[model samples]
Target: MTTHITGTREEWLAARLELLNAEKELTRRSDELSRRRQELPWVRVDKEYKFETEEGSASLADLFRGRSQLLVYHFMFGPDYKAGCVSCSAIADGFNGIAVHLANHDVTLSAVSRASLAKLLAYRRRMGWTFPWASSGDGRFNFDFNVAFTEEQQREGAVEYNFQRAGHAMDATPVPLPVAQSAAMTGTDATTYSLDRPGLSAFVLEDGVVYHTYSAYARGLDGLWGMYQWLDRAPKGRNETGIWFRRHDEYDRR
Candidate 1:
């Protein structure tokens, strides 16, 4: 009944049927997820968030300009850091080409961090990207999103997360770096703590006001409209996959 290389025609057919059924189950789940996504509700973003751009400070409402929907990519660039977040940077790299299409949907895409406009401009030049990037240098917007903090908050506890080797084993250790140091490392050319978290946020704009519709972090970005996990699963894969990260200075971001 259990021969390694000797299977009846009926047995082979049964195995194939199982595979087909599994595939069908996966498709059904995917369809259900999409339906749920479409049914999700939106929230109002009425906070007084501000952004620092080349033209100077602007409110979150101003970010919409005249659009109906506002999507903010909370880039990691505190005023204390030297550069921006590499993972966030990688995502930002994919925005310029897509901004054209986003504008067509009445949605404007932009990046906000606490880095100064001058620093952002220089880094943008170095990276050879043209997407609209701004700073929250003079505002508490970063803290509002829980991506930033104050001196006291930093002292409480800050265990950076690394995707390459986080929660994979039972004997995991925490890396403790000073708040200033950790914050500074994020925007620099050096590799950062790999096991923190990544997040996504969206806001809705009605009339001349904005509302915090939703905010998602970690793998919550999965299965969204613009999912790109397949590309990272390719043979060459992506830099953030596994223990695969190099200094930004070493990579040809351009």
Candidate 2:
């Protein structure tokens, strides 16, 4: 005897064909991303910043660590935070192998954060990550690049430049603008706070100078965010769900 099924063979086969179309679409899209990664639109770095590496203090350019192309994962561990964001934490989990292989292509990758060296080291040890993680604790590399929010930038309206707080308290609630009826709220305003974009940014070293290449945010980084997707995109999607939460047993919240 065979297990009963709901649909006809033709219907089942058609359904699978639809899934194949989706998978192929995603494959083409992924390949396009790979092409985009070949090289980024370059921008020259005008200001020099600093970071603390295991070797010791180094300039922003030095984070390249003698590599030609650099890709920095802006991990979200704020200056005062005790830990990194779980989303970012998950991404770092898959960075192990890529760390070694990317070097073969003259490309280098590192996780950059504002956490102090001691804190970064402790956390890296706990995560068992082998990638080179650096601390930009004393520098404005983060703030300048719009990846780390600083209290000063918030007050100065450098980011989240909302006008509602023109004369209001930073702690005061915002008064919705009457004009909002005509315009969709930008989710943030002049008075809103800026958390900076904690994602990926690339650079290339030319004539011994680092040039800002490109950056991405949110789902845009689904490609290199981890290896589970890369592995799942193979012949079979995956044996199990690819998501997990704080604990190894608990599933991550959708």
Candidate 3:
């Protein structure tokens, strides 16, 4: 009655054992990649970046909060959007529980966006998230980090994200379906929504100076999306088809 392959217990164990060996190898490779990420050179941050945080206006270094390291999630909440990106919101959900533990380990984790602090706070309350969310509305922090793009860049198809000239689909004559859908969810047009991209950046404060360590974007961020990790182990894997997720709260409404 099942469409999937059915196997005897003995056959299943043999196949699972083979998978376990491959899984172990993948784990070892992941560990090596992490080490290589740490080995990458840190670039000194000379520009003074400002952010509006819950406490008050704070500098990039101030974001460390007495910690030596900082991890910033470049959330896509442009000033014009009525709400945050649903994809980024899903990622932030995972951030809430781990932030306190990371703080205890001498690392500060925060989400930075181009939206106003007031808007961010209201949305944070809406989402019931306690993790620090800062607004980079007054500064070039998002742009300098290559997550926010200017109008000219978008118009000219000159936006560069994840270390390459990108956003072509977003700039197409007819916006891509998924991009348009995501934009609609945020109450923004496709171009306006695409102007702000999602990413993660790492920083370290050494001897009173902040240095950029590493950054990842696009599929590079898959590891950080908690649900995908679980889904990968599910019978149907990701089982995705054109924007299947919502802003945690939107699911119930559906």
TM-score: which candidate is best?
A: 3
Model 1: lDDT to the true structure: 0.61
Global Cα RMSD, each model:
6.8, 8.8, 1.4
How are the candidates ranked when ordered by TM-score, highest leading?
Answer: 3, 2, 1
Query: Which model scores highest in lDDT?
Result: 3
Write the candidate numbers in order of decreasing lDDT. Answer: 3, 2, 1
Q: Assess the local accuracy of residue 41 in candidate 2 as a C-alpha lDDT between 0 and 100.
A: 69
Q: Summarize candidate 2's per-residue lDDT along 12-78 as a digit string, tens digits.
A: 9998999999999989998997788666667889897889999998887788778898999988676
Residue pairs whose backbone atoms clash in candidate 2 = 161-190, 162-189, 162-190, 162-191
TM-score of each: 0.69, 0.71, 0.97
Candidate 2 TM-score, true structure as reference = 0.71
When summed lDDT is taken over every stretch of 10 residues in candidate 3, the lowest stretch is: 166-175
Q: By the TM-score metric, which is better: model 1 or model 2?
A: 2
Regions of model 3 farther than 4 Å from truth: 167-173
